[model samples]
Target: MSNDDELKQLRERVQYLEDRAAILDCVMNQARGHDRHDADLMGSVYFEDGVDEHGPVIKTGPEYGDWANAAHESVFEDHLHNITTHTCEINGDEAHAESYVMGAMRIKGGKIVSLMGGRYLDRLERRDGVWKIALRRCTVEWMMSGDSSVLASGAVKGFIKGKWDRTDPSYTRPLLLDGEPVSRW
Candidate 1:
């Protein structure tokens, strides 16, 4: 290719990457707000068919919504989700993103509940000129004791730390269920 053509191609490639990164950031922010029990924020991020694989259960759009709302009502008076170390790749109209998420929930008793930390693997699609999550899988890395009662009562807690890159070794951990390692990734 000529020099000018090569430069144009490189610029286009950079622009594509930027667009994908922006979309991923939006998705992450939405998820963070949702984790903090903001249904309105979560609703903005998900498409009609969005699927959430949380822990050992698979939740469809409505199911996920119910779960989120219920959890917010029962455990938290307020919540905040922190997302970091995001890595994303775009392939035409489809893309995949992985991000580290940490969340803290303020419980009714004035105690904080935190889910250790985890990575979110997401499948995104460009639909009607907007990027939205089609599928998402959450992989918990570890948990810390924010509150014994909350932990005993099945509340999750924690904040994300470490690097955010798809090729980072941190994202390679296997999932677990009921103290047993899960086979599906």
Candidate 2:
């Protein structure tokens, strides 16, 4: 109706979108942090007293960081977390979200553990202009198990490049076209 009213409405809509984007960034940060074993980054996604339930075990933000990092290091030689769809319902300063996730791990016992599908349900709250997780519940829907060693049973000799930390090539290597033995992937 009035120009002033229209401008106010548009600003509110922009704020809503910005909030949604910030929340999604948190979601991705969790995935990347866990996979990279960056405990601090992972913990930053949550409030100081935030809680997370991996199955029936519930832990506070700091507790989860310690537990998850230890478990990943002891149980898996390597692991990757991939987040898919994310849907959030914003209610002013609070929101509820569910993020679909899949993960594959190279277990220490030579097993390949695959969580084919799962969901991270989150309760978020914004305080002091910052949105953070107040709670999270992870539910695994399906999984497949295999032998990790078999994947390299007949491997050729080479320096297969990868690292658990920021030293990974993804942090530095420039794009290049594929050559004879290098697939550029």
Per-residue CA lDDT of model 2 for 18-133, tens digit only, reads 99999999889888878877778889999999999998789997678778988889878778889988999999999999999999887776556655679999999999999999
Off by over 4 Å in 1: 1-7, 147-185
Minimum summed lDDT over a 10-residue window in model 1 is located at: 161-170
Residue-level lDDT of model 1, residues 1-185, one tens digit each, is 89999999999999797768767766775665465444555666667888888888787754575677786668655565678788888887888989888866657675566555888898888888778788889998987646536443434444332222232233355632343322221
TM-scores for the candidates: 0.67, 0.83
In TM-score terms, candidate 2 sits at: 0.83
Model 1: clashing residue pairs?
85-164, 114-156, 114-157, 114-158, 115-156, 115-157, 115-158
